[model samples]
Target chain A: MSCWETIADYGLRSIGIGERLLPRSDFTLCQQFTLIGSGLIWNIYFGTFALLFGFFLATALAVGKAAKSPFIRKPSEWFIFVFRGSPLFIQFFFAYFLFLSLKSVSPVFDPFTAAWLGALIVLFLNTAAYSGEIFHGALMSVPKGEVEAADAFGMSGFTKFRRVIWPTMLRLAWPAYTNEAIFLFHATTLVFFSGFPAWQQRGDALYYASYFADKTFNPFVPYPILAGYFILLTLAIIGVFGLVNRRLNRHLPDAQKGRMKFRPNVIR
Target chain B: MFSFCTDPQSLDGLPWLACYLTTGKHMAFYASFGTVLILLAITAPVALAFGFLGATAARARFRPLAWLGKGYIAIVRGVPDIAFFLFFVIALDQAFEWIRHKIKCPDWDQPIRQGNDFVVCPAAKLPLSTSPQIWHEIYGFFLAVLTFAIVYGAFSANVLYGAMRAVPKAQLETAEAYGMTPRQTFWRILVPQMWIYALPGLSNLWMILIKATPLLFLLGVEDIVYWARELGAAKQARFSDYPHGDWRMWYFLALLIFYLAFTKLSEVVLARVTARLSHGQATLGGTGRSAAP
Candidate 1:
């Protein structure tokens, strides 16, 4: 079959579209690229949604961790500690079994056993914990002068935080947060490998890559293809986050602006 | 484990629980925690050595050597490390056998890559294929350690390289003015001072290395995750002495708690070490009143 036909067949195979069965034998490079690229859709889906939702929770977590009330602060601190301290690979397994038990308890939670929802929830919580810590550090380091300037202008409470504190906290946190975002995307590869089952042979990029590797017994091709796709994805993340970072530091002189360096934190 | 615990069905209450916890599989499960600790103990210093070499090579004056160092550091930047873990185990095994094949079976003319099979002479087989199962496990584990070292070496190299650059330039210049060679200056001035900057990153890497121990399951090493899954599956009455519904959630919970305690302890120890290392230095940690400025 032609490469175009192969792409047409397996391009959307990861999401259960276009084709039902994956290519079985005589695997071509086109088949590998198309299937693995298809699997990347799931990675993008998990990364995008988790990051969008996790950002708000992370902000809330940062704020709560910085709160004066012990009731609020203690839970935030413990939550961050527990999530951040444990391996995300273990988190996926633990959350899977937890959801499985929950499913046994209630039929409403049946969907929670699936990777799309269940693994997403795990990733969301995991990223939120790490990002919350980064934001907490940034929040703590927000210059005293910045808050003082806001108070001198009669700003207090929410206004002070919204206008002065939040922006600077984000500006300080963006570089590290960008690294967290990259690692979170990388962590998404662990979803299928963990307890969550990939429904109907539809798995993420690494899953498909592993499938190809298992079939061909050649680790060279599929993994590098997966890596190439991820490199593109990483570049895309850097570009987008770099734009937000530029905007965050727009008020600063060029010399004072914080450049977004790609400090790769290997794992979450 | 107890005298009266002969029959699990007849037993009840705490006695049954105690007996259940002492199963043979539970012992292996407990031992696997030692496996993780052993991996950390071995991989940390080895990876640091790799990092030091990589950082030094990157700082080398020769163009090709610097590129080699930079390339090693860049390989892990964008790729998911699980890919490397999965890739290296197989790739390294093949490479080792292929080299052995060239040396051992020099007269053989058959192509090594026949379709999907990587055929090497039996002499080239890792652990000889007839070796005991323990040898296989050890060989698998050795590859895992190497892969971990390689991936983490890159991360540490990045940290060490930055730390090397962060050392005050004047300190190195003063060492040079004192007629010390570049190598002497690097050994005396740069290596000693870079640790303070490198400590934070290395500590972070150490925590990452701790958390990454679970990936051993993927490499087929029968680590904690493997044992947890194996032991926590629901057991039927016919299957074994103890029959229970799925208890994997609890097993994983215990594992989670173990990791949390380990990381917390490491954090405390690392904080103390940072303070100790910061002493007498001009940095904020040194000048701060807590350290006898």
Candidate 2:
């Protein structure tokens, strides 16, 4: 079959659209790339939605962790600690089974029995914990001098924070937050592996890559194609975040701007 | 384990629970945690060596070797590590057997690639294909360790490379001025001081290593995750003593708590080690002691 015919059939294949059967034999390089590239759609779906929703929860969590009350602060601290400390693979397994049991109890959790909802929820919470920790660190490190200045100007707590502290905290935390985003993107692959069924032959990029590898008995071709797609995705992330970093630090002098170095120390 | 456990079907309450937990497969499940710990113990040193060599190669004077080292560090980081884990284990297995095939059966070769199957000469199979069950398990484990070493080695290379750069340049120059050779300077000044810079990154890497041990399940080793699922599946009374509903949630919860406690203990120990290493150094952790008049 022509590559275009292959693309037309499998392009939306990951979401269970046009194609019912995956290419089973005599797998061409073009077929491998097309199918795996189609699978990239799920990676994007999981990463984008989880990140979008996770950011707000992370912000709330960071604020809660920084709160004066022990009740608020302690839960946030443990939430971050529990999620951050455990392997995300285990979290997926735990969450999957937990949700399955919950579904027996109530229909409210029925959506979570599926991979799209359950796996996404786990990723959301997992990324929130890591990013929350990053933001909490930045929140603590917001310059004391700036707060003092706000107090001297007769600015109240809410006004002072809204005007000065939150922006600077984001500015300080953006570099590390960028790293967490990239890792979380990398982590979406774990969903399929972690007992969250693919529902069909439909799976993510690594899923399709491994599929071709199993069929062709050649590890060299499909895996690299998957890697190539991920590299492009990673670069795209850096590009988008770089733009945000610029906007965040636009008011700062060159010396004051904290340049985003690709330090990989932030927890996965 | 109890005398009352003689009749598993007859026992009830806590004794039944006790007997269930002590079943043969459940014992194997517990042993799988040890497998994870051993994988971590072996992979850490192997990965460190790979990282050390990679960093040294990155610092090599030869251009191609330097590029190769740099590329290894970069490309590995850009892709998801689980992909590498899946790819490298199979690729390495094939490569080893293919080499064995060529050497052992020079004239007897039917094509190794028969459409979709990867066939090799019978004599060339890893562990001889006739070894005991334990030997096959060991071979699978050996491949897993090598795969993890290659993947995480790239990560440690990145960490150590940055740590190497973090050491002050003037120290190297000062050593040269004191009539120290480059090799001597590197061994004495650079290596000794590099630990302080490397400590934070290495500490983070250690936590990552602990978290990554579970990936052994994906690599087809009977690690904790595999056993958790296997033992927790619903069992009928006819097949086994432990007839139960799907209890995977409880199994996974135990695994989660085990990891959290393991990480908590490591955090405390790592903190103490950091404190000791920072003594008499110039970093923030050392300032109090190092400022002594």
Candidate 3:
């Protein structure tokens, strides 16, 4: 079949859209690219949704963690500790199993078996803990002067936090937060490999890459393509985060402002 | 392990639990924890050395050498490490045998890549095809270690390079003014000062290395995850002493707890190390004060 015809067939294969069966024999480069690209849709979905929801949760976690009251601080600390302390791989497995166990009793909770729900839940919690820690640190490091300025303007507690502290905390945390986002994107690859089944072979980029690798017995080709896709994704994240970082640092003098230096490395 | 434990089905509650936990497969599962520690122990220093070499190469005067080092670090950093673990094991195995084919059988004209098979002479096989079973396991483990080292070494290189640059220019200038050679200045001033800066990144890298241990399953090694799944699957009562339901979740939960505890301990130790490293340094950790970066 022609490459365009092949693309049409496998373009939505990962979502169980076009192709019922994957290319089994005579594996083509076009098939690997199209299929893996399709699979990337899942990764983007997981990363995007988790990040969006995780952001607000993380803000709350950060504030709670920074709170003087033990009631608020303790749970935040423990939550961060539990999520950040465990491996994401094991987290995926444990969450999957927990979700599975939960599903046995309640059909209302059936969504956790699906990657959209299961993987997203894990990613959300994971990112919240990580971004929470980042924000906590940034909150602590919020300049004494900034707080004083807010206080002089009759700002206190909620008002102070809303206007001055939150923006600065987010600004300082953005770079590190950007790193966490990239890692989360990469961590999406583990969803299918963990206890969560791919659900009709609807897997991520790594899944499709592995499929091609196993079929051709050639890791060289497929993995590189997947790597290229991830690099592009990472670069895109850096670009977007860099723009945000620029806006956050816009107030500072050029000399004092920190450029968004790229430090692309994984915790796992 | 006790005589009474011989009959697992007859035991109740704690006794059954003790017997179950002490079973042979459980022992193997427990030993896989050691496998993780060993991987961490071996990979960390090796990766550091690789990183040092990489950084030095990248800093080298030669253009090609610098590009090679830069390229290695960049590519490894860019890709998901799972991809590296999956790809490198096969690639390295094939490359090793292909090289051996060239050396051991120079007269052979057959291509190494023939259809789906990678045909090297039997003599050219890694572990020599006649080595002991332990040799094969060790070889597989060694390959996993190399892949870990290659990937993590790049990360460490990034950290070390930044640490190296972070060493104050004044200290190097002072050493140069004192007539110390470049090498002496580097060893005495740069290396020592870089440690304080490098410690945080290196410690973070250590935690990551700890977490990456489960990827041993992907490399075809029977790591704890593999063992967990193997032992936790449903078993017929006739064939197995401890027949169980699909308890893979519980096994994985236990693994999760194991990792959580390990990472917590590492965090405590790393925090202490940072505190120690900060002492007497000009940086914020000095004088028992926390410095914000």
Candidate 4:
């Protein structure tokens, strides 16, 4: 079949669109590329949504961790510690079983057993913990002069945080947060490999790559394709984050601006 | 195991719990933790050695050698490491066998790649295909260790390269003024001073290495994750002495707690080491003074 036909057949295959059954035998390069690219839709989906939602929680967690009240601070500290300290692979396994038991308890949680939701929740909590730590560090290092200047302008409490503290914290944290974002996208590959089942052969890029490897017994082809797709993803993340980074540092002169450095954290 | 633990069916309360915990599978499960520790113990120093070599080469004057080192460091940065883990296991196995195939079956002319199958001569088979199961496990483990070292070696190389550059230029120039050779200057001045800068990154890598132990399951070494899944499945009364419902959540919980404690202890020890290393140095962590001082 032509590459165009293969794309038509499997373009949206990962989300259960177009073709129902995956190509069984005599796999073409187009088939591998199309199917693995289709699987990347899931990776993008999980990474985008988890990061969007996790950002807010991460900010809240950072603020709470910095709070003076022990009640608020202790829980945030422990939450970050527990999530950050453990392996995300184990967290996925434990969360799946936890959700399975909850499903047994009631029908309300039935959707929680599926990878789309279950694994997303695990990634959400995991990224939030790591990003929260990054933000907490930034928040602690926000210059004392900035807060005082805000107070001098009659700013206090939430107003001071919103106008002065929040922006500075983000500006300080963006470099490391960008690193976290990149690694979080990479971590999404572990979803299908972990305990959660990918229903109806719908899996992520790594999943489809592994499937092709299992079929062809050739690791050389599919893995490099997956790596190519991820490189593009990483580049795209850097572009977007770099734009925000420029905006964050817009007030400063170019020499003083913090550039987004791509320091790859190999694993979570 | 208590004296009355012989019959699990008759036992109840704490006695039943105690007997169940002491099952043969539980022993293997416990031993698997040792596998993770051993992996860390072995991989850390070996990966550091690889990193030191990579960093040294990256800093070399020859352009090709520097490119080779830079390429090695950059390879792991763009891809998910799980891909590396999965890829290297199969790739390394084939590479090993392919060399053996060429050497052992030099007279044979059949193509090795025969439509989706890697058909090496039986003589070229890893572990000989007739060797004991233990040999297979060891061979698999050796591949895992190598893969871990390769991937993490890149990360450590990046850290050490940056740390090498972070050492003060004057320190090396002083050694040159004293008529020391470049090699001697590097060994005496650069390497010693780089450690203070490298400690924070290396400690971070160490934590990452600790957390990554779970991926050993994917490489098929029967590590903790494997045992947790195997032992935690619901057991029927007809199957064995221990009958229980699905307890995988609890098993994984135990694994989680173990990692948390391990990481926590490492953090404490690393902090102390950092403090000790920072002493008498001129950086912020050292004497709380500016570099100018």
Among all candidates shown, the one with the greatest DockQ: 4
lDDT for each residue of candidate 3 in B157-262, tens digit (9 for 90 to 100):
8888878888888989999999999889878888878988888778888888888888888888889989988988888889888777778789998998898899
Give each prediction's root-mean-square deviation over alpha carbons.
1.9, 2.5, 2.0, 2.1
Over the stretch B244-291, how does candidate 4's per-residue lDDT look in tens digits?
899999999999999999999998888888888788788888874211
Query: What is the docking quality class of candidate 4?
Result: high
Clashes of each: 0, 0, 0, 0
Residue B155 in candidate 2, Cα distance off native in Å? 1.0
For model 2, how does the per-residue alpha-carbon lDDT over B69-136 read when each residue is reduced to its tens digit?
A: 89888965579999999999899999999999999999974899888899998999998867899999
Higher-ranked by DockQ: 3 or 4: 4
When candidate 4 is compared with the true two-chain complex, its DockQ is: 0.82
lDDT-superior candidate, 1 or 2: 1
Off by over 4 Å in 1: B288-293
What are the clashing pairs of model 1?
none
Q: For residues A1-268, could you state the per-residue lDDT of candidate 3 as single tens digits?
A: 9999989998998888997998888888899999999999988899899999999999999999988999999999999988877788888877887788788889977998888898899999999998898899989999999999999999998999998999999888888888888888888888888878888888999999998887777778899999999999988888888888888889888987776665653354
Could you give the CAPRI-style class of model 2?
A: medium
How accurate locally is residue A245 in candidate 1, as Cα lDDT from 0 to 100?
97
What DockQ values do the models have?
0.80, 0.79, 0.62, 0.82
> Which segments of model 2 are wrong by more than 4 Å?
B288-293
TM-score ranking of the models:
4, 1, 2, 3
lDDT at A72, model 3: 97
> Against the true structure, what is each candidate's TM-score?
0.98, 0.97, 0.95, 0.98
True contacts kept of 1: 0.70
Q: Which parts of model 4 are misplaced by more than 4 Å? A: B288-293
